[model samples]
Target: MEIRLAQRVQALTPSSTLAITAKAKELKSKGYDVIGLGAGEPDFNTPQHIIDAASASMNEGQTKYTPSAGLPALIKEIITKFKSDQGIDYSPNEVVVQNGAKHALYTLFQVILDEGDEVIIPTPYWVSYPEQVKLADGVPVFVEGSEENEFKITPKQLLDATTNRTKAVIINSPSNPTGMLYSEEELLELGKICLEKNILIVSDEIYEKLVYGEHKHVSIAQLSPELKEQTIIINGVSKSHSMTGWRIGYAAGNQSVIEAMTNLSSHSTSNPTTTAQFGAIAAYAGSQQPVDEMREAFEERLNIIYNQLIDIPGFTCVKPQGAFYLYPNVKEAAKLTGYKDVDSFVEALLEEAMVAVVPGSGFGTPENIRLSYATSLDLLEKAIKRMHDFVESKMKA
Candidate 1:
């Protein structure tokens, strides 16, 4: 029987990051020593306190389904976190806890967007943003973030992209792939433009806690009371607390949107895992030491590996200020090494050098490649050396 799949499923592109990671794993399973730089989460384990909390919840029979939105306790902790970190305030009714930050965003797009509504996404964006928007029946309008500007779009670019059909704009600071952060002044400029255009702001601050030296993560919603009302924040403990497997994330914004998402989730996913909610509560309310330690380690790795990456012939990388990924322009290297594009270069790297990194094409920047520094310095060093040697061999050929 020939089955007709839904158009949405047919149109969706599988995440390239996950694809590369899987390929690397397949090779490793077959006894090949493949060094993978495609990781999207912290290499660290979830804090023991969070694990204990999940165990305690299960032991106490808190394993039953939670409220579709989230546990009141977890919501309270989320509110406290926003107040302390971003200086943003939200009522409990305005927040919805989903399976993870990704799900939180998926729900947000579903609730707020109508068919034909256009979402302005700045490139190079997270691999999931455009796909998620398309899945929700919204058109994604791409605004290029040039490498010269550190991959950030200017206010003028945002203004030019706005139209009658523009429903929202996504802002991912400490952005995935590039790991570049937007300064307060820059965010204020962009927020003002969004406010003037009456476009909603979907701020993805999943990497908020992972910022590096001299750079602070600013929430666009925190810029003003008006912006806060117009913005929806997407955050999770996955990156911050190394709780990716816990599958707990939350969205904070307009009450109407949150209620609608909660209603949708009730029918769709029910509630986020009940035990994960308890664990997330511990993540937010527990000691800050573990989070701090992880951030320190990532920063250390970034500092060490970034120098080596830039020194490689034909590679140009801007210093990443946050997140765990480094997106380096490899177009010159590809051209120098006789490959047609970064994707081809990446494939050869994986097959020949036994190293895995995500090609930038999936992130809307074909001239670059994203290498995650979330792994240990030892593994990172090995991966970079392999990549360097691979490039050198190509140049000689």
Candidate 2:
């Protein structure tokens, strides 16, 4: 069978995290006590008020499809959230709500990128960005960032990656897999370059609220009025409100870009779930005490796991300022483990220590592994202990 799948599908790679998680689940079902460190979301419930709002909407017969751009009320809520949290301002008409942050990003590519268009992405980016660019018939130009630089790309590097065909650049602060957050000044410098180059910026700020220490998430659009006009700010309540299942992501950008995405939405998903939109409205407009409480807990666990990783031999990790993941370079450990690479190290950990982790190759970096400390403190401590023991054994060998 020739199996006529779309050519775009051929360019896409499967999610490494979900693959690991499925394997972990299989092993656990077979009576193995697998400690999963691969999941990217927090192990918390959606806030009560948000849940209530969804129920209320459903009871009120708000089950019909919303406008493709999203409910005007929800868009208004998103505007308020951006202004209050990231100091970015946008009119409701500039906002387009979709299924999730991922959806917004993919749609942004479809709307802006033409065949052979180039998108400058920092290396070790989210696993999906490169694939998304390819799916949209765009080329992804990677600018490598080292662990020494806190996994952030420099302005010079950004400039070098640009070409006349460059369509956009993605800025993910509190980045996933690495958890590196960019400072406000750093973003301003990059924003200035984008202005000079007349390049579009796709700012993924889903993890904005999860940052720690002095690292603040400043939307590059907020750097100035000109930058704002050229930036598409992608965000959702999934990370902030622990509302992953709600699927209420949105983008704020130039009216034309937003309108194009809205038209795309009209043909594809039509709209996000109506009840979820109502709940997201409450998530934004209601009290934010729940989000703050969860952030505090994550901060506490982050400190514990980070301090432990610093003491482990043959392993090095940058203290992630935001997000729940820690990307530790395990090349030293890989050499000791009789494993050829990061994939083998991850496999050995899961098989020997019952610990599940994502291989960094999925995010364009081998010789590293990603561990999510989004679980409870007890599990995080135990997972770290097990990982430490595994590394010690490797070193002894």
Candidate 3:
């Protein structure tokens, strides 16, 4: 028998983070003491109220198919959330719910892009952004956001990347891997360029609520009516509400684009899970104390562990303003520990030190590694100590 796969599927790169996680899990299953610092979700459970809402919905027989885009109630909650959180107004026609924020992004690219169209992506980006763009037959144009600037692209950089085929640009504040947030001023400058160039903005704000002390999350869309009109916001409860498994994410943007995405989703997901939609509605409409508590815990962990991590031999890092990941430039650590690169160092750390961290190469930056603090304080401490000891033994300095 002969089998063939489509070129798009063939062109996809498997996630390095997931691969490392698989290996870590394999070791764990064999009773190895692996301390995984590659987590991407909150360590806490979903809020009790949200769980109760989903359970209540199931008990009350609310588990039938919903509107292809989402339940109307869920859409309404999303609308209210935007108004309250970002001070942006959205009509129901401009919002569409998808399986998750990842899916929301995937669907957005599908509807908005055509073959050979270009989307500008800042480097050190989330692993899935470029992949999703490519899946839509859209060309992803990468622009490096130097670590000196905390890995944020400049307005001039965005201007330089624009071309006749440029269709959109992605702005992921409180970014994954780097955990950097764009200032309001910075976003305004970039938004001006996009407005002049007529490039649509895809704003990924999944980590909006996880910002740390003295730093706040700002949406490029929140800058003005013009910017809001030019931007589509992709957000979900996964990171914000510890609802990773619920898979309820929504997009708010141009009515026409939203309509197309809704039509596309109808033929695909049909609808997000009914119970999960109910849970998301409750997540938005209920008290947000749990979200705040989770943010505080992450901040405490970041403050404690960032200091400890940088203390390790040959490691230097930018203190993240938000999110739970610590991205440290470990090229020196790699060299000092007798490894040739960050990827090999990460592998050796996992196998020898039993501390699992993600190599930054997957995020388009090979000199660094991402260590997620989305675990308990005790485990984070243990992982750092292991890395410290491993480096001390290998580096001898």
Candidate 4:
């Protein structure tokens, strides 16, 4: 028997981050004492109150299926969250909960994208964005952001990428891979371009709560009501509350888009887990003390790692304003080691230093790599030391 996969499925590649994570795990199992900086998740466990809320819900027999959109009370909480935190007013009916941020993203593409439709995604993006667009029969237009600009795309890039078949633009602030946060002024400029082009905005704010250093996250919807109508705001408690395993995420947008996502969700995952939804409700409603403490830990780690990484002989890193990852350019190290690219550089680092990092080539930026600080301070410090030693050794070689 022969095996052939669907074209869409064939187009999808396994997540590069996860593939590196698995390799790290395998090395760990072999007693390599690997330090995994490839993880994109928080190191902290879910808060006690959220766990208790899930238990309480379970005891209350809240195990039944919820409405395809989500439980009414949870949807109401999302509305309140958007209004209070993001300063955007969304009705409960205009929100749809899904398995996770990734689910929310894929579903949005399913509903909006058509064959050959183009989506403009700034480079150094999350690994899944381009693949998801391809799965939906859309072309992902890559707009480059360099180290000079802190890896952020300018409004001019958006204007240049716009075409008749360009259906949407993905804006991820406090971005994945780079940890670059967009300022309100920057977003306002880009939002104007999107509005002028009549293109939709898919704003992924999954890392909204994980920012630092006086960096404020501004929702495109908060920029203007018109932009809000054209925006699909994706967020969740996974990163905010360290509840990634619970898998609850949502999007707020036009009623038509919400309805479409809800309908697709009904036949798909049906709804996110009931207990997880209950837990997310508590995460949104509970005391934020835990959130503050976790953010502080991440901030401290970010500072320590940033300082150490940039001091390495052939490494240069941009100071991240948000999120827990640091993207460092190691082209000089690549040159010294004769590695030829970031992938070879990363593989050599893992083999010699037992430090796991994701190469930037996966995110469409070469000669750079991402290191997650979502680990212990001791581990982060040791990993930096090891990486520095490896780079210095390459220079000598």
Tens-place lDDT per residue, model 2, 1-397, is: 6678898997689989889999999999999999999998879999999999999999999999889999999998888887887687888889999999999999999999999999998978898999999999999999988898999999999999999999899999889888888887898899889989999999999998898877777778887889899899999999999998888899999999999999998999999999999999999899999998999899999987788876766788888989989888988878876778879889989999999999999888897889998898898888888988998887777
- Pairs that clash in candidate 3: none
Cα lDDT computed for each candidate against the true fold = 0.94, 0.90, 0.93, 0.90
Query: CA lDDT of 156 in candidate 2?
Result: 96
lDDT score for residue 364 of model 2: 87
Q: Candidate 1's error at 243, in angstroms?
A: 0.6
Supply the TM-score for candidate 4. 0.98
Clash number for every model? Answer: 0, 0, 0, 0
Q: Which segments of candidate 4 are over 4 A away from where they belong? A: none
lDDT of 4 by residue, 298-380 (tens): 99988777888899877888899888999888898788777877799899889889999998888888778999999999999
Q: Which ten residues in a row have the lowest lDDT in candidate 1?
A: 385-394
User: In candidate 3, what are the lDDT values of residues 100-204, reduced to their tens digit?
Assistant: 999999999999999999999999989999999999999999999998999999999999999999999999999998889999999999999999999999999
In model 3, the number of clashes is: 0
TM-score of 2: 0.98
Q: What is the TM-score of each candidate against the true structure?
A: 0.99, 0.98, 0.99, 0.98
Which portions of model 1 miss their true places by more than 4 Å? none
- Which pairs in model 4 have colliding backbones? none
